[model samples]
Target: MASNKSAFVDDKGKPLRIADSAMPKPGADDIVVRNHAVAINTIDPAQADGFLIKQYPTVLGHDLAGEVFDVGSNVKRFKKGDRVIGHARQFLTGQPEDGAFSLYSRVPAGNAAILPDRFEYKQGVVLPLAIDTAACGFYEEGYMQLELPSLDAKPNGRVVVVYGGSSSVGIAAIQLAVNAGYRVIATSSSKNSNLCREAGASEVFDYKAESIAGDIAKAVGDDQFVGLFNAIGIPESFDVVNPIMEKLNGGFLANTKPPGKLPSFIDAKFVLCIGDFGFPVWENFITKALESGKLKCLPEPKVVGKGLDSLQEAFEVRNGEVSAQKVVVEL
Candidate 1:
């Protein structure tokens, strides 16, 4: 059994501290990973500020890149010593031990994806939540529900507008949408425009420009644009999306936040990415895509500090604006 030290939160909204936690035992389909790196997400702080906790002294990590230290009897996909990356299910399942801030993390085999040797922990750690969140907005039948991405496909003339393209979810959306064969038009700060383009977006617009809406309207004119994927869930971005949605003549609008009032002409839905659905994408393509350079390690990791002690500071950094960057803590 792995004795553990984790960044523990004594209560909701409390600062995280390194503390001893019980070693998490795996279920038949789970694997215990020894985390090498962990990344912070805005949702971590948001969860801390909310009423989601069912227990105190809970762990709070989100994204992890690590090695499999042990596996359950029924787990067949991974073996001891394999390097893997996975989305911690604590927030989704409300289980403290399931978080990934510790020396070891217990995660379902389905939620874990194998990472290529060429990429280090930091490069691959940013993907789990980003990929899961983007998939929820893109493939859930109630959301965009576009066709699943295929490896051997070319552009199909369909287009998607990804708002906040440099954010973690936006980067993942750009790649996934492109893999599904749709042309992507994204919005990002000019400094990070190339990152979005690197993810396969054909055209990227500056969200700060006064003429942004007109720019998007011109590029998507009468083209088969399905809708906008709002990665930045703030209310103000709706103004950006609405005009483009109007120009597209009422397509779909999928967001990472709670669904809000939208024009009746368009289909708007809020996507809560349940972690279970993320496996298909991970098992089927993420590994290969990374190897082939189709999917990228994006919003590059901005290391907050080293060791489990740095988690609190890392979480604090996420409370402010972090454009085209993922705050990570290297273990």
Candidate 2:
């Protein structure tokens, strides 16, 4: 075991400072990882500003990629020296216990999956958050059942729209839908249109265009869209997409909202992604997709600074910047 320093914000809401914490011990179904990289997300700043509700003095990271340093006796999936990535904390309380923004992390064995030899730890860090979000959005309980269409058949040519296609969650959703043979149309800034197309979108539309829904309808034809993935979660975006989406028979919209009422003519499905949904559901699929080359890694996050001490600066960059790429801290 190794002791490490962690960056944490005090109650005053000032910049995070390094504090000493004990090295975590692995339980019977746990593996201890010596962290190599941790990716920052939009939620980090909300948590920092106390906008996103969570336990105070909490370790804030969730997406992690690193090498296994130790394993418990019952951990049969991974051994020492293996590289893996998964959920940072052991449970899915939405409040972090010990997070990945530190030198070492103790991850539950069931939540960990081995990284492919062809991929680096930094690239692997981008998988968990996106994959988990997509899986939970599509298959979580009480949502429409996802029955696989016939193997030797066409997909009834149904259209699906993904808002914010360049965002991490939108990228994953587009790829998943396209691989499953659905015709996907996505919205992105003009600069990210090529990237969205490469991710398997049938067509990319400019979100800033005054009539985005009409443009999508013209491309895919009338009343063809059956589902929507709103990765951006903006209230105005929902207002814009609702009228066009109402044409479908039983179309549904999946978003990150935490249990709230949706506008008329649209059914909003609240997705809470965590270990409770069966950790292996996403971890297994992502590992196989990586091994088979079905899923490609996002651009390597631009490293702002090195080691745990740089977390404050990294957090500042995450809060201030409005770019498509993730900000990662190398440990």
Candidate 3:
């Protein structure tokens, strides 16, 4: 058995501490990944603050890229030694071994994908949580309800807005929306405009501009407006997004965080990234799109440190101001 050590949050508002963890035993539908790299999400700090953490002294993380250390009997999509990226399911399962911050993590086979050889662990590690979050915005019922992404998607003549376009979820939303045949308009700092375009956004607007809402509304003029995916999702972000939605005459609003007050005309829903909806996309779309260079691990990976001891600092770094970059720790 592989000896395991994890970065554990002993309690809410406490610093992470390194400790021994049990060697993970995969369930029939799961695989154990020996994590080579782990990506930090904004949700990690929230978890430390007791958002989704139901127990004290639990591991918390969502994104990891590694080699398969073991696979369950029922999981044929992977085997030992296969390089893979996975969405660790601690939030869903409440299991410490299923968290990405550990050296060995138990991941659902459905949420694990074979990483293409061409990509590095840090690059691929940025996608899993972002992919699921963005996909929930577009495909989840009561959200945008748009079509799933594909290799050769024809234009669907609809337009979607993604605020905070240079964010992790923003980058994924732009790519997935474009692949699903919607013309994506996005908001980012002027410095990150090219990143948004590189992700397939048709237009990039500066969020700092006073006319941002009107500018985006005018950009979608007369086009079939699908909705806005508010990747930023803070209360302040809605200051811009709500106006755009109102101008678009109350279209759908898919939010990554809790939304603020909105007019009755606007249809809004919080996107829950944990779901079965991501599995088919993982199995059928992600690997091929990656191999074909259609899917990019955008915003790029910003490696913060090496090893599990650095995870606490990585968390601090993530909580600081960051833009267009995913914080990763090499394990």
Candidate 4:
């Protein structure tokens, strides 16, 4: 087994080298995973470009699918050789821990979930962050609080709109809403319409169309949607959906920077998935959902190339590509 391997970003905000280092020893509450695949998220590029940069030469991956090679003595949830997914550290805290870019990664026991037998490493790798984001939107502070007054009533066949439906978070939102029996309408490029449909969206609107919001309103019958989930945090996304939001009965869930002024009629809730280490409820909900397969994993990630040598190329590809699929690196 290789002792240490990582893809590090240089001072110029570019991926410079994949080098060898010391492998981490498991702590009493941690497990070491022999990584098979690592999934890329937008946050990867953001960190690389200093959007959320904390330290230089930081390892740049969050999601991974692998097998447990060893566990800390206090860890009881997993055994050696068990396939698993490593949840990203939401709050970096003060640790300089290497992320999933390396061949072996150490994660807390509560931050790892056993992969279902039906999923391959690639299929399971993209889910941890996306699922957590969706779970945050669905539940309250990480607990599965299904107490929304709208859900408790009789079948009103309420509608929920998900903007940027082709994104990983959008996909998870659609699935979670549909599984909860809500009618889902989503907006995405025409090319990704099929993916939106496959994720259980009742209606898919071409976001690139000139009258995209109008098209969504026409389909849902003028403000029939109860909630709106904005997976894309762009300012234009908020503008396009604002009109429809006026007609909704409930609030909106946004994954962008929190807005300063609240909108009328619709409650706008900004969802920041990470940066909260004190919330044990959210972690528990995600762990249960993944283990139970209530939250289905994304399709097998498209591997750019094998090993750390391909890191820079992979980063470039990820930064430029706009596919609905998740980009992954094989270790």
Candidate 5:
């Protein structure tokens, strides 16, 4: 059996510690990954705050890219030594053994996708949870539920405004929306506008502009969007996108944060993207897209440090400020 070194949060609201432990054993539906690189998410703090943790001395992490260490017999798609990117759901599942902030993690087979050889571990780690969050906004029936993308999908003539398009989920939302055939109008800083365009956004606007909302509204004059997704999910973002929604009189607005007050005419839902529902997309489309050059990891990976030992500082950095680049820690 392989030994494991994990970043453990002994209790809620505690600092993470690097510790040696036994490697995780796979459940019938689990696939253990020897993580080469891991990425942090906004949800890590909440997990450490006791929001999603199931027990003390638990682990907290959501994104990782690695090689398969082992697999449960029931897992047919992967075996030992496969390269994979996974959404570690330890916080959601409340299982310490499955946490991604470790040398080894056993995530559900459903929460993972095969990583293409062209992309390195750091570049790919940024996608797992962010892509799931994006999928929740667009594919989940509780949220957008507009349509699912396939290998040969065509444009459906729908539009989606992905506010904060330079953010991690925003990048994923732009790519996924376009893949699903919606024309994506996205917002990012002028510095990151090209990133949004490269992610398949049909048009990109500067969110820092004095008239961002009006700019978006004017850009889409008379063109109705099926919905708008607030990737930043802050009240300020909703305030910005609300005017655009109002232009069309009504549509959908799915938020990544808790649902707050909204314009009466707007139809909206708050979605937490932690579940097996996002599996089909990961399994069905991501690999093919990557291999075909249709899906490129974005905005890009900015390596923070190396090893599980650096995770505390890494998570702190992620909790702090970052721009178009997602923070990554190589194991």
Candidate 6:
């Protein structure tokens, strides 16, 4: 049996501990990966504090990029030595082996995609959670419900607004919506405008601008407006997002966080990224797009530290003032 070492949080609000764990045994439709890099997200801090987490001394993480170590009887898309990016499902399954804050993790085949050799592990590690979250906000029926991404997506002549376009989910949403045939108008700080445009957004507005709401509205005028995908779901973001929603005469607000109260005119809901929402995208679009250079590992990754012991530092860095870059730990 192969041994595993993971950074575990023994209790709520506790520090991370490095300890040995049993190697993951893959079930049918699963693969065990030797993680080369793992990216941290905003939700990790909350999970460490016990939000939505059911057990103590559990491992926590959602994004990993590595090479396949083992495959289950039912997993055909991957084999030993194949490189991959995975959306770790510990949040949903409550299993230590399913977490990414470790040297090795068991990943559901549907929640993973092949990582093309063109990109490094740190670069591709930024995609899993961001991709899944964007998929939830854009493809799910209750959310934007637009269209699934494809290799050759013809323009559908509709528009979707993505606020905070430089953020991880914002960048993914912009790319996915564009690949799904929707025109995207995105918001970012002036410094990140180019980053959003590079992600396929037709226009980028400065969110800090006082006239941001009106500017985005003017850009979407008389077009087939799909809705708004608010990647920045903080309360402060609502001040800007609400005005834009009102300007568009009320449209679907697919928020990435818990949406606060809004006027009766706005159709809004908080989007939880957990689920099989990413399966179709992962299985159908991700690998092809990456191979063709259509899907980019955007915003780049800032590797904060190395090995499982660095995961705690990576978490802290993610909680700091990170902008347009994901904090990663190279294992």
Top candidate (lDDT): 6
Supply the global lDDT for candidate 5.
0.85
Q: Candidate 1 — worst ten consecutive residues by lDDT sum?
A: 271-280
Off by over 4 Å in 1: none
Mind giving the per-residue lDDT tens digits that candidate 5 earns over 1-331?
Answer: 5788888899878888888967888999889999999988878867777785678888888899999999998999898999999988786667778788989998999888899888999999999998888888777776788677666779877788998899999998888878888789998889898999999998898876777767777776666568888898887776667767776676888888886877798888887778766888888999999888788889788898999878888778888889998888999
Candidate 4 local Cα displacement, residue 60, angstroms: 2.1
User: lDDT-based ranking, best first?
Assistant: 6, 3, 1, 5, 2, 4
Candidate 6: RMSD to truth: 1.0
Candidate 6's TM-score reads 0.98
What does candidate 2's lDDT look like per residue over 1-331, in tens digits?
A: 4676666656536667678866777889888888888888777666667655455566667778899988988988889999888667622443333577767777777667888889888778876667667666666676533423222225557777888888877887777676566788998889998878887787999888878767776777763666788877767776656655653433678876552556576777866545445364444555676777666676447787778888888888888855567788888
Off by over 4 Å in 2: 51-54, 90-97, 147-159, 220-224, 247-250, 258-261
Best prediction by TM-score: 6
Q: Would you list the C-alpha lDDT of every candidate in the order shown?
A: 0.85, 0.71, 0.90, 0.70, 0.85, 0.91
lDDT of 6 at 228: 91
Point out the higher-scoring one by TM-score: 1 or 2: 1
lDDT per residue, candidate 3, 1-331, as tens digits? 4799998888888988889999999999999999999999988988988897878789999999999999898999998999999999999888889889999999999998999999999999999999999888887666788888899999888999999999999999999989888999999999999999999999999998989878988999888998889998888887787778877888788988777677898788888778877887888888889998889878789999999999989989999999889999999
Measured with C-alpha atoms, the lDDT of residue 233 in candidate 2 is 75
lDDT of 6 at 183: 94
Model 3 steric clash pairs? none
- RMSD for each of the candidates: 1.5, 3.2, 1.2, 4.2, 1.5, 1.0
Order of the predicted models by TM-score, top scorer first:
6, 3, 1, 5, 2, 4
* Per-candidate TM-score against the hidden true structure: 0.96, 0.87, 0.97, 0.82, 0.95, 0.98
lDDT by residue for model 6 (1-331), tens: 5679998889999999999997999999999999999999998988998888978779999999999999999998999999999998999998899999999999999999999998899999999999988888876767778789999999998999999899999999999999989999999999999999999999999987989878988999888998899999999998898888888888888888888789887788887777788899999999999898778899899999889888777778888899899999999
Query: How well does candidate 5 match the true structure in TM-score terms?
Result: 0.95
